[model samples]
Target: MIEANTPLLRLLRTYWPLVMLSLGLLIIVAIVDSSGDVILAQTLIEGLVRIVIVAALYLFIGNSGIISFGHIGFVMIGAYATAWQTCCPYTREMFMPGLPVYLLNNSHHFVLAIFLGGLLAAVVALISGYAIMRLSGIAASIGTFALMMVFYSIYLRWSTWTSGASSVIGLPTTTTPWVGYAYAVVAIVGAFLYSRSKWGLALRSSRDDEVAAKAAGVNVFGQRLLAFVVSAFFCGMAGGLFGHFLGMLTVDSFGLGMTFITLSMLVLGGMQSLTGAVVGVVVLSFLIDILRRLENGMVSGLNLPTSSAEVFVGIVIILILMFRQSGITGNQEVYWPFKGDVSASSAMKRQS
Candidate 1:
């Protein structure tokens, strides 16, 4: 057992990974804010949001070893949920007549709306995951894809609730860089804590060997559902941030393109560790931004086609897959610079 008088250095060493990630984010924020480049700042803000989402995905996918194709569905639910409560009351009444009287007649605070949106998404995950988590392997992946399609089709046809393919505008532009950074830090901490929890360990055990984990008394499905719900909550929160940042929404934005890009980020970052999630988003976001500038001719002397960014990312993904299946992080996290008894430290942390 750890003593109450443990040195401050020891405590910091125990959580150095979290400290490192948080400080790294702060540095990024500082640099971006000082750049005075609105477009660059926006790109970083979006990248921070992606960190929230990809971190959420890491909680489940990394621990469970299951590739999910439907998390964007939860993101969709979150965006629409926030939009319903926070959009202009007049606009909601006019565009979404199917909403109840309270929804149509009143507006909610953006923070509350974002929280509600996450809660709603979590509830949906609880309901859907009850069924989806029962399946395993490729079947489970297919189930999630179907779920995404279901959300898309429902939102597309249900004009009353979602404006039927029309953009839902009037969201408060409140998701500044700091807000995004704060949430990203929260997500990283939450993910790290979860990874260190008994539930996360059990899920990973099942991921490695289901029969062995089951023999070891792990309730695999229950653990999976828990991860799913928690993951959805953060993804939903990301959706809320995204909507507020853009000050608008469209169902199409939450479809295959988003699903593919986010999954790619996760896979590219090595999907097996928390470090990979953040690293993946940072690396890919910067690459995309550079490619976008070239494509848009923001940088003189070079010009590319409109869709060149996507093509380049695709090529990068292919190269990474072929040569570095474990991604740039090699399925590992950033460890403390000074090596010590990591196993002992991990055990102590788990005990605490």
Candidate 2:
């Protein structure tokens, strides 16, 4: 029973963007391609994880009025947790010997490993939330960022445990495009439910005006903690899925680069609207694809070479931030044009 004029989402279903037809088109594409189609499938699957993580980020930041640069740490933690599960002690005996004795020894148990990774991430967030949410503004961001740096150092230096810089191998990828899209659906729905729920409203109240929301009986810290925990859980799940999809991972993959990229997506799409996050990830992903093609041409045939496609992405981010500070949605609903219906819905919602 959740409802909102989620603009990009509703617009995504329209005929013009062709988004309404993308899933079907991709399905056909997957079916038609037989040779090394797995690569294409893997890309799509990882994109799904990105969508979920971005959605969760929007949910938390939207409600809590907080910014985070450490969500990627959750991804790193998840990757290591899953990697340890599939560590293959005999092959890389110098590193992790095996998972704890209580867990499955097979190491290739994809479902179990992924579940463990997500759970581990949630647990970390739950613990960290208590400490981090106690602060406000830049303090919270800086603290969580320190947490990520500490985790990164541990993963990099603890070679005996995480195999240091050597890529964790022997992982079995169970992620697919279908699996990714399913997650995006679930995450989007979950974010919608959260935005419409009483708890979500309380958090949003705090986001809009902390003193006012506190007067209205919302424990601001508690609301922030709850959002952080929920956000971390989904982010962790996305990270686990990503780990298995690539079948290879390193601490560097979930670094500040990822943090900046996702934050850019959130900003470009609209921080207050989950629809914005969806749009951002899709647009950015496609942007990356186009830049890669362009870069390929430059390097292969044209003779001029570029350092990184991310430079192009960075430029897009700067432009979006400069031109649209409130982002595309600007705290407005997609169907705000439907004044009568939207007003009624708002009135009924307030009454509820």
Candidate 3:
């Protein structure tokens, strides 16, 4: 520990300039982001939502070294939970006319409903993680994707609860742009904190090589499960806000379409870097918005076909994967301090 700390302390002193630059950029992003018009502001908040979700992915995929194709299931569950709580049903005047006796129909409290939505997702993750984590490589990815598909099928058929494919309308528009941005910042900070914690190290070790890590007494299954479930919780929260923000949600938001879009954002930034995920969400989301605008706007000669945005993002992802296979950061991060690099080493050296 002492030996490592000396090198870490030296690195911190060595790279203070980089540290300052990063902090300055973050402050600027927060300030400028908050000052935009409501429409643009909302878009920015949505960007933050993606940032948080992608950051969580970085933790699991980046640290635990597992790719999840269907984690959107948690978000689907979350969107419905919040939508059900906040919307007025035909029976209850509060909900609509009246809610079922046991359904807990009030969604007025923003903090509570959103947290509950996230919690519900986490609970689902707890169960799902156990089953899915048992698999490895492409097998685990396929298994998780299957789970997402199964959930999607259920949601589409469960008209009594999810409103099926028609659409879930009347979700109260209480999720503000600010709240979304706040949560995004929290997610980024939290992910950074988690990935630098002791558990993160174990998770990363597992990702790098489960057999080797396990040989050192690491619990690979547990690590992957822990990382994945945490990521799922935030994804659910992001979805809940998404459902409410638009004042309605469709099953499609939590479908394969969203799964790919969000994953593409993460992939474009970098599969291995938390920084990459954050950047990926910010940059790709804006590009997507631009593509959406182009699709909506008539071209110089003719109107573009519908769904062009999806096509564009898909192409972008393909190019990124082809050209930049290491993923945004190759599992590297800017916070080398907490990453147990020089910072941790410095502490150990000081103690020594």
User: Which residue pairs collide, candidate 1?
Assistant: none
List the global CA lDDT of all models: 0.89, 0.72, 0.73
What range of 10 consecutive residues in model 1 has the weakest lDDT sum? 1-10
User: Candidate 1, residues 1-352: lDDT per residue as tens digits?
Assistant: 3332358767776677799889998999999999999999999999998999999999999999889999999998998998888886667777788898888888889888988998999999999999999998889999999999998999999988889888888888889999999999999999999998999999999999988999999999999999999999999989999998999899999998888888889889998989899999999999999888899998888888898988888898899999998888888777666645455545668799
Q: Which ranking of candidates, highest lDDT first?
A: 1, 3, 2
Candidate 2 backbone collisions, by pair: none
TM-score of each: 0.94, 0.82, 0.82
Give the CA lDDT, 0 to 100, for residue 88 in model 1: 67
**Two-way TM-score contest, 1 vs 3, winner:** 1
Candidate 1, RMSD to the unseen true structure: 3.8
Which candidate leads in TM-score?
A: 1
TM-score-based ranking: 1, 3, 2
Worst ten in a row by lDDT for model 2: 12-21
